[model samples]
Target: MTGGSTHEIRPLRFGVVAPITTDMPAWRDQLRGLADSGFSTVLMPDVPQWQPAPGPALAVAATITGLRVGTWVYASPVRPAWITAWEAHSLSVLTEGRFEMGIGTGRPGIADQLRELGLPLPPEGQRWSQVRDVVAALRELDGPDRHTPVAMAVRGPKAQALAAELADTVTFVMPQIETRAATVQRVESFDNRRGAELALHVPVVGDSVAAFMAGPDTDPAAVRAADSLAFLPSDPAAAAEEIQRRREEIGFSYFVFGADAAGALAPVVAELAGR
Candidate 1:
């Protein structure tokens, strides 16, 4: 009960949550910035806060070669399964086969957020059904020449079953598990099989930047300082070693970071991106 899109992901790959920007000039710059800065891919969240829609933004970013683009995890409850299908097909064309459709049962707070948008958040059981519907639709719409990988971000046992059966990449987000053993257990629970990729959407911040930003007059806004977000060690080499050890135990090949922490995390990217 596994899906078929394996050629798209690689071990030790890194991607960043795209920075928000309304103008094309800045958007293009940011897309190129990721490529130049050594991120393997660029991810756009399918949240209301984004300026351009995730599919369209990925399409635009695809104009730059060698940069893979994806929706970090589209909240399936927010739209009909067919609409989700449309996005997958559209992004496949838009990115010329360089897109990954990441889907999830929208998170907790999003229910309140969706209420503001005049959309009700469906229960977990219903959202799980829609997730299956979306997967089936994507498979039906896919042809040999036009295809997009589906990345399922799910945590529960039922949802994990759906992900294992229908996703190309299985993603997990567990920022609260602060220990290596805890992180390893979380990833092991995915039980990723052959022909699938494992992507862990987690925090990554280097030590040097944290130390520098701790100075008395450090501008919080300038550095996007947040102690909770800095999860890795300070030294680039030390971070690389820790990440390598984690990857060995957890089998997570793809790592994603927050948009604001890109500058702080770049040193690790530099240290381990191409290796």
Candidate 2:
């Protein structure tokens, strides 16, 4: 279930994770930088403060930047299915059809925030059910009239199956386990029966990056470096080798780099370009 075409040497398609900040100018600048750096896609997740609203910033991002823009995992419980569908459609149209929407159950922190905002919270099981329904609603849109393909970020069996059944792609953040073999098996086990293509979301870290500074409590720097290196090759040829190796091992062909800024993005982009 690969997203788009996987016939190229690098079966993995590269994209950057958008910085979720309220500063619209900074966000647009980051998008421009990513476009200039040769990123083909960008993942804009639903952050509490940096909620995705179809506005001028997104409009400019679509108009000025050539990179494909989409959400990593937009929270489904935050809005009605129709509203989410409408916003996604608008962005897709605004971007001239370079948008994709990834829906998922709200994370714990996001759930808490939504609760504070007085939004109703569904049970965990029902949340996944809603995820499927949301994707179905988006799929109902007419061709060319729809802005983006809908995908889901999932971890468990139930969620993975939902993604497989409804979404065009399935994205996974690197799990706590250390080995690529484990990662591959985990994704395969969850995704084997399902048909959605897999996309692995790997973070790219550098000095002064937010994730680097504020990740889990155990040697933050080392964890940050390790996470960044997961998608990177030890050498130039190694990238292609790793891509093929992971694809054969795990069945995933899409790679998304969740980076901090321009500086952190350059090295990864350069390495992928060499591949």
lDDT per residue, candidate 2, 1-275, as tens digits?
23222322334466766654647677777787777776777766665555545333456566768877777667878888777776777777767788878778865466677878789888778888777666666666635445368778787778867776667777764533345655655564563343556676554333333342123443435644444324443243555566556666566567676546434546445555434
- Give per-model TM-scores: 0.81, 0.77
The sequence of per-residue lDDT tens digits that candidate 1 reaches over residues 43-83 is 88776764667877777678865688888778887888998
Candidate 1 residue 140 Cα shift, in angstroms, is 0.8
User: Model 1: how large is the Cα RMSD against the reference?
Assistant: 6.1
Clashing pairs in 1: 207-234
Quantify all predictions' global Cα lDDT against the true fold: 0.69, 0.61
Q: What range of 10 consecutive residues in model 2 has the weakest lDDT sum?
A: 1-10
TM-score of candidate 1 to 2 decimals: 0.81
